[model samples]
Target chain A: MARKIDPDQREQHKAAIAEAVWRLVARSGLEAVSLREVAGEAGVSVGRVQHYFGTKDALLLYGLRLAQQRMEGRIRRRIAGLVAPGAEDVLRATLAELLGDDPDTRQAVRVWTAFLGRALDDRAIAEALFADDVELRAFTTEVVGSPLDAHGLWALANGLAAEVACGQTTAADARAVVDHHLDRLLGSPDR
Target chain B: MARKIDPDQREQHKAAIAEAVWRLVARSGLEAVSLREVAGEAGVSVGRVQHYFGTKDALLLYGLRLAQQRMEGRIRRRIAGLVAPGAEDVLRATLAELLGDDPDTRQAVRVWTAFLGRALDDRAIAEALFADDVELRAFTTEVVGSPLDAHGLWALANGLAAEVACGQTTAADARAVVDHHLDRLLGSPDR
Candidate 1:
């Protein structure tokens, strides 16, 4: 006889699985994740993992999307509260918060970094991230007033994230770079 | 009884193993590597992997160190021929070369991005990268001036790499960003 499962319970189970996947990735890197491993970590059967995610790649892809949306939501909320800062200042604040070492932000960083390598082969994720990157770089250029021909903002943003991920520099330092770039963009002493 | 192996032949085999390690990591990822798998890739026995690396972690750590050294050597070679370029110019050239999409450079980048996720959990690789990253950022700061702090430089480099890795931006765009950032560093007219 097939056992009826509760919808809410299933949703809760999926969330638990994602959380477990995140924890495992954080502790051991994304390569360390496996269906059996995730199922065991989440205290669920392998059948549950299959039912929820279909496959390991599906789980990973879903996890990646979850991470992206969560991050976008965080930034949107922070941007909502910026009140009256200049476009550059708002950008700096937004960037600082995104790269800062808060708990949730740190988890996102780990997940982002973990998936970055795999994105080289995952066309779907690569396409999405690439589009998002283009938009982000354009927004940065508009706010900072840097008349970069193309890929300028993206490079700057990339360099900053790599440094932060490597612990070679701090969030404050990243903000300072944004401010300096903004100053150049504004071409004014006040800036 | 174990067959008697020549020391020189043994050293050659170790080198071969390390080379294959990077290739596998670049083509797939660190997770795809295992002692037996690497041995097969290198046309050697599993016992040879154990003999050379002692353990999987040791092999990974060694491969990571070699990868960084390979990158540093490439960057140094690129910068060696450069002359009369100011700090910003130096940085632009250095960064452009580092992030270039040439086959060799791309291989290095692939190995780098893949290993970094593993490094997060492997203390040995983490410590080594941390040191290397500091030196790289410091050099970048020296070229970019005070306003473009190390962390900012780091993030910009990282973001650019990610952008390129995901094909959101072209190598030409990456060069453009480096050039613009250099111009800003040199206090040139904005845009």
Candidate 2:
């Protein structure tokens, strides 16, 4: 009888391979990411990568999904530690997470930017990337308790973060911009 | 003695080569942009492309510059045709221009996005892309009559446009988001 694969170990293997994909993408670009190179980057055999991800396109999409999941995890962790975080605080934490202040997230953003470049022409890629962004917008809408305001707020906050990620703006400047918009949107502090 | 160069023809040649760079980049990704490939795409000789751009790095950067210049020219033409355009009207036009409503712009954004991905890790590319964005912010500031608000406005508007370009948001949703933010922003209409 064939040995059963451990579900936990399978996830670990997939995430590890996805991490390699992100690394290669951040280093060069999406077009540079090949299964062979990704396998080498991850110190695994090409067969192992193919075993988990099946095809290059599937691997690329999975890498992006993993990136989104990781970002969401970061947001959740940051908010989890707050003693009494309000909606504004939660939103701030979320935006801050998106700023990609740390190395891992910054790398992820680089990977994302490259994929986003190709996504415009590739409908499947576009839909996958759009789904990730929609999740963010959905969370923002839930937090704001108003769909009308959330769209703009999500765009502004993530836009600012993206500027930071791409080095178009400083973290400080993005924070200031975020605060300026939030101040106008939220008005006086609730508590 | 070399043949005399016509300044107009020189610009046309450079723009044509750069346009080829954009098409290749938009079709594939920046990594796909090789000097020889760009020449092939432009139906020019490798020597001609090298003569104009010197190196692949210079060619890529020049392509981005040409793209930005074309966008500016478009924006100027749009605004110039407007009879007695107001600050709000001018801002709206600028924002709309950024929406990448046409195939050309949508393709350009794909190129920019790829560059932006690499820009995160490459200082030169980041600075070049940042400079383009800064010019847009400066223009927005000039229109807003307030530097304080321009950063937020520029980010929001372009952020919305980028979302549309990436297929992350519908043109309708982005426009509604822009109008919502602008309504809160501009207050009562001024004829």
Candidate 3:
């Protein structure tokens, strides 16, 4: 009889592997990530990890995509809880999410930064990363209204995230800076 | 008879080593920076490299500090050339220098980013890097005046630098954004 393969089980395994990769990235630099180390960290066989992700490039790409999706999902959930979310609220929430205050967000930022360093050389990653930047710019432009370009807004948010991640600025201070910028770009924050 | 070490030649050798490390970092990520590779790139013996900088940590630290000094020196020269440099002029010039459009500034930013990633795990580097941040904050605060905190300004500059380095935005675009922010903070750019 053929063995049964459960879809949920497979996803859980992939997520575990990704999580392990992220931990390694957070602990060491991106260079520390390898199939052997990831498998060891994830407590799985190297063949199993290879089965799930064919190549290190694919694994890394999946990890990057996963981090982006997790951040987007988080922003969506936060906005959903708002009684009546406005454009400014959406913008504020999105920037705040990128600040990477909490553990999950912090890990995501680490993974993102690692990939960014790599993207400097890898054309494919650069293209994908730039696409994300374009999407961010569009969303920021829509929410903030005219006179505020997405490039500037994106830079400000990312700069804040980098500072927060590097311990140069506290999470609260970063949030305050973002809020101040928002207030300047938009009107005074409601309430 | 023991050969006497000339001060100027020692300085030149160290600068060459640092430059090689910067090139390695710019081409690959921080992990590419090993004593063997650096010595090979610098066209010097590993023993000579170690004689100047004892370990990989010291080598990396020296490279980072050198990059910072080069940037500061460039900014100082630019500011000195201005007939009558105002606060806005100083702020604009400092930010433009960080944008990494030129070859020198581009290499500096790349090395700085690599050090930053490593600084995440290295306590000594983190402390030194934070000190640099503090110094930058003080300088920005002095130039920008009140109502604009140094932390926010630093984040904006770094964010812009990261974006420019990652190819998400052009150097000219980053400069415009900085000027726009300056106008908002301190009145419109004078002359």
DockQ of each: 0.49, 0.50, 0.51
In terms of docking quality, model 2 is: medium
Q: Write the per-residue lDDT of candidate 3 for residues A9-72, one digit (tens) a residue.
A: 9888898899999899888868788899999999999999899999998898887777777777
Better of 1 and 3 by lDDT: 3
Q: Report lDDT per candidate.
A: 0.70, 0.78, 0.77
Model 2: DockQ score: 0.50
Model 3 DockQ (Cα-based): 0.51
Off by over 4 Å in 3: A1-4, A128-130, B1-4
TM-scores of the models, in the order given = 0.83, 0.86, 0.92
Q: Which run of 10 residues does model 1 chain A get worst, by summed lDDT?
A: A145-154
lDDT score of model 2? 0.78
Error of 1 at B46 (Å): 2.7
Candidate 3 residue-wise lDDT, B48-117, digit = tens: 9999999888888888778778888998887888888876687777777787467899877766666666
Residues B1-191 of candidate 1 have per-residue lDDT tens digits of: 89886888876777789878888887777768888789999998999889888999888777777767777778778777777655555666667776786676777677777766666566677686666666666776666555365545556666676666566667777667755665555656333
* Model 2 clash tally, residue pairs: 0
List, residue by residue over A46-91, the lDDT tens digit for candidate 2. 9999899899989988898889778778889999998898767888
